[model samples]
Target: MAEQDGAIYDRLTRVPERDWDKNAGLDALLNGAREPFVLRGFVADWPLVQAGQRSAADARRYLLDHARDRPFTVSIGPPGHDGRLFYDADMAMNFRTGTGKLGDIFAGIEASEAQDDPRTVYLGSIDIPAHFDGLDEANPIDLGDRDPLHSVWIGTRTRIAAHNDFPDNLACCAAGRRRFTLFPPSQFRNLYLGPIDNTPAGRAVSMVDFDAPDLAAHPGFVAAMAEAQTVELDPGDAIFIPSMWWHHVEGLAPFNILVNYWWRDTPAWLGQPQEALNHAILAIRDLAPEDKAIWREMFDHYVFANDGRVTDHIPPAARSVLAPLTSESAGRLRAFLLRALNR
Candidate 1:
């Protein structure tokens, strides 16, 4: 019950106690619950067979056997400087030594060393049939040519700072537990994002510190912390974190194993327009406070019009620009933007 961080972390309150058959498919679990939902004890059919049974030795062997053959990248945590830790590039490089054995490489390492090691491992395009032997069908998610079923081994009690990914991710634990802190899109203002356009891999600054955050430095974080929600996941259970929701994950136990599936939606490309809106904010909206205020007012007129007749405000000539999306129409719009940019 101890609160170590600024955010509140707790276990699943409503654990389903029934022991249903282990071979149950994921259709019910995936489709029954709506978006932004959490379910306890949802285990994947294929991986659950070897769950808790796979030893650290087996995992190490698997990683070494596949390291040179695949597009796998290892994250060995970050580096330490003046007692404050940052991601280290050297430790990540050490994985290349000694055929990458877990015991040989990670033995006698302090928590700070593990945290700074850049050996964060990611196996890209894992062949499903090759990885998980004797699986009938692929999980509904498509992970390119790589296996949709993948595993993540967290060696230390590591912290994954706040960020969001493109696809909907379903993370199931095979060993140990993890604590997840989540915030909806509306809470972005509270999250205090570092850079609007930087990739997640490149973001180096953390928005908030749970142990001892400087309230004076980040005044808005206080309001955001009040609205945050947390969930702790146990072994044999899974959590679905939808697209665009900011999440911060912490490995609570050592030798943790997580198998996750990342799936994209057909309309996943909606973010392109949102990215354009962000660019518009930078190019036009942020130029002057008065112009920003005017743009906000106009946006309200278009988005919040109760009469459902804001289309009336658009001029006849500009009507085509706002027309419904079609392949041909989209092409014309792209051409128009290109011409405008070139001019």
Candidate 2:
């Protein structure tokens, strides 16, 4: 398959798998390396997985019984989109979104199955605790004291284009199967990134379609594919995606649901480095080549390789801007940026 298609490279890496247990040693897995890894049998004993093993109807019942009849957001698209939700020619979403009850979506799924229809419905990223009250208690992953924000994605054979999330993620398969094609942050240049301000998804997505990639249009995508790794997860299986790792997700089965936990290890005061990069581009990108070269050295010395000695040459009392970055210091920086921008 890889040889025939230039988008699917033959020498792609594989994600390491770990067995699920009460003591899964997640801290070691998370803290040691920022690489993606899977945990087999992670949520194997959850009621949702058991129900999925029985039948789609059983899984639907388990969810409806837990979440009740509350209205949730659902996205609908024609088969032309091929279950891939993304932007069209005018930068508008190819699909449309509407709020509806969960039962309506499940019924739509069943009806579509019976009729062999091409229209698809998706209830993506619904808050578990807010919508489904008692569901979290029934199925828990035991992530220790750190309470991660939980969300669920329910759909039928959907594909999400390659995009990166800011927080570290644990995506657990509750029902059906999923395939993830992951690329490291370094592959960003070859991915053909789309608009930053306007996006179909929350983040800037790659214009190249993974399933039917047009190599002629996006030649650099071949290089990105060479560095890509694909992983398939069954019900009860889970995968950890480190922050800023680009991933393309595909839900394989007719009826599927994924529960994911997202959390960040860094302090909130540190903020997102992506924002800083955007600001740097605005402030420094248009400078003369010589000026830019000089700024690069300044950044390297002060920002990248400053191991506590970059500002050591300056008196501690006078190093107000270069001082240690505490929450108060961050607030002061924010105020300075606000004032500079307003001017």
Q: Candidate 1: list runs displaced more than 4 Å.
A: 1-35, 48-52, 62-68, 78-156, 199-206, 264-274, 297-321, 335-343
Residue by residue across 1-343, what tens digits does model 2's lDDT show?
Answer: 3213634434567778865456754665667458989998888999889999998889999998998567899999887566888887797988999988888778888888875556767888899989997888888877765568999999987888899999989999999898888999999988999988677657889988776778899899888988889888899999999899999888888888899999887777776777887888899999999999999999998888976777878898878868778788888988898899899
Candidate 1 lDDT: 0.51
The alpha-carbon lDDT assigned to residue 237 of candidate 2 equals 92
Off by over 4 Å in 2: 1-11, 68-70, 287-291, 307-309
Candidate 1, residues 314-336: lDDT per residue as tens digits?
78566664544556666777787
Q: What is the lDDT of residue 8 in candidate 2?
A: 48
Which stretch of 10 consecutive residues in model 2 shows the poorest summed lDDT? Answer: 1-10
Which candidate has the highest TM-score of all?
2
Best by lDDT: 2
RMSD of 2: 2.9
lDDT of all the models against the reference? Answer: 0.51, 0.84
